[model samples]
Target: MTEGVPATAGSTRSTSEKTAIFWLLAGVLIPLMNIVGRYRVRGLENVPEAGPFVVAPNHYSNVDPIVIGIGLWKSGRMPRYFAKASLFRIPIVGAILRKAEQIPVERSGNPRDGAGPLRQAQQIAAAGHAVVIYPEGSLTRDPDGWPMRGKYGAVRTALDAGIPLIPAASWGAHLIMPQSTNRLSLFPRKSVDIVFGEPVDLSEFANRPRDSRVLAEATLKLMTAITALVEGLRNEAAPTQRWNPTEHGQTEIGRFNDKR
Candidate 1:
């Protein structure tokens, strides 16, 4: 583990409170969002029942995490997500996030430094809690609509810890809240599909070298799966676009310096 990022304290609330907050939010807001557009969920059962697992998804909007959390919670799981540290610095929201044990990631471009939150995330997952990570590290801006290159920290941490890596796909969140913008407009009642992909086994790398090449391959494979899922979902929204690397300028991965 890198220096200075201490492990988070466990929540004082019982599982009931956690479950209640999750369901109440999902039940109230998810349906309201769905009423605007049909929420077509697939591969939900792909989420594990109990165990340390990584929920790696394409990041498009801030709402992506909320929607992802709701979907996971509905499926009898709740993920402690790695979020921007700045978000956790918010007054009430930050306090809540800190209490909820969410990992606060520093987004500067230093690898050794970036590992702080990731290490904490790995600890959380290793302790038998689901953890959500955005491998891409930021939202995508592909003119042709494709997933960007994913960073290596998420994959490395999951593989090193021997945790299940679950790829996730989300659509329509960008419309609700686009990248680098805070103003949330009333969405067009679009159905945002949140799908979970089958777990990718990285046990081979669990003992293998953590070389740059090895880590990059693992990260790429994971990102490819996520990009494929995202492309599929995007195609559902706009059939004309394809996620082919040649067509899309870049995928949503590796779009930021995720250092603390």
Candidate 2:
């Protein structure tokens, strides 16, 4: 634990709100996470002690959600994610997700359907829970693991809900679960570092019309803050230009060859 971090044990939600499955999963996952990787968390004071807030972190691996979720949990905030709708179709997994009240995101191409997930996220955040939205939408296609161009979903949500948009960064989780494969290397435990930064300043766009240009700029600002935290954790300089899948002829979603 770092200085200035909150000492609260559970999330912002009351004990009665947490479901049995949520606790069961927490019990099994938290201990296992500790066993697999040594974590050093910082900037806990940035997380709000109460009320709704948005956590936007860089996405690089399938394990990121778990790692970030644990980070939020340790910071005394219940983390809710916008998960894929298909995940809700799995047998036991779907049941558990539903019981835990995780929001399902339907990625239908229809622009009309797009608003549904964001609406759900807004509702969740309004209820005083932390909503974790990966601005990159999927794992970074950047060969160096730097965060690529981000989507506007995270920025839009925070702006619509009028909540704090906190930029967070996590480094070294890829060592435990690389983007290339699903294997877990637990023998030699890796060091995973997660840092939370101050809430992004979106006041300029608060009253502006939510046009594409404005939203894109806000997303870039959010991504820039997240990248800075990642740089501090890794002690390395990111590329001058952020990665863009479209420019590189890569699909926005799903796994693709990282090699250029």
Candidate 3:
């Protein structure tokens, strides 16, 4: 565990695991995010006063995590990401992530073999920290940019750890670093917004057997909350039906254009 700065006055609980590395990274990235875009946030009060909670945001650009982290920093909680293990293998970036105590997620291999990451996520929340997760696992391929079907890991971690699930959504980050390529556009600043919705009520799923049906229901609830926030940011209604990438034959791992 790493510790950095205390939580804001609104939080009864101070952030204990925010490390100096976290602060350094935030000090650099938050301004960078602002340099590339306007950082507009809302509903920070919706974040629990003190405890472990999950920040489930839709993935759209490579910059999403950085933007989300900036928002959480303003809200008084240091944000931790469930980054892919391969990313932790990078020389400098990996070392920084390790120092910051980010959790590494294994996205490949057998489904049953993925328990270690989820277990680690549970442990983090159980320790009173927030983990930023992209519920769709990667950037959305939903033609119109609405949240797509999500994996159940976020809900599972929250339920198992008895923490609240905070649905976060972002829109303008995609414009800063477009989803179609590994490129950056910083000349004309974009407007990026990340909103945190009220904790999703998973009371019904509490203490119940985590069957597939229950997990599916819980996943949809998170997606719904995130979609609502996204719509509010984008000022457009989400498609009534959530997009399923596999059904639509879009690759879940790489760049996918809606018009493609």
Which numbered prediction scores highest in TM-score against the true structure? Answer: 2
Model 3 scores worst on lDDT over the 10 consecutive residues at 1-10
Using lDDT as the yardstick, the better of models 1 and 3 is 3
Off by over 4 Å in 1: 1-38, 236-260
Question: Distance from true position, residue 156, model 1, in Å?
Answer: 1.1
Q: Per-candidate RMSD vs. true structure?
A: 7.1, 4.5, 4.9
| lDDT (tens digit, per residue) of candidate 3 on 54-156 | 8899888887888888888888888778887888999999999888768887666457755888887777666677887788988888866789999888888
Q: Could you tell me how far off, in angstroms, the CA of residue 87 lies in candidate 2 after the best superposition?
A: 1.3
Give per-residue CA lDDT, model 1, range 60-146, as digits (tens): 676777778767866777778777788887998888677677888776656666768877987786577788888766665544335
The 0-to-1 C-alpha lDDT of every candidate, in the order given, reads 0.68, 0.83, 0.79
lDDT of 2 by residue, 1-260 (tens): 11222223343557544557767988988898888898889999998877778899998878888899888878877788888889999999899888777888776545576688899888887777788999988789999899999988898998887778999999988998898887777868889999999989888888899999999999999999999999999899999999988888787654546656
**What root-mean-square deviation over C-alphas does model 3 reach?**
4.9
Residue 251 lDDT in candidate 3: 67
Q: What is the TM-score ranking, best to worst? A: 2, 3, 1
Residue 139, candidate 1: C-alpha displacement in angstroms: 1.3
For every model shown, the clashing-pair count is: 11, 0, 3
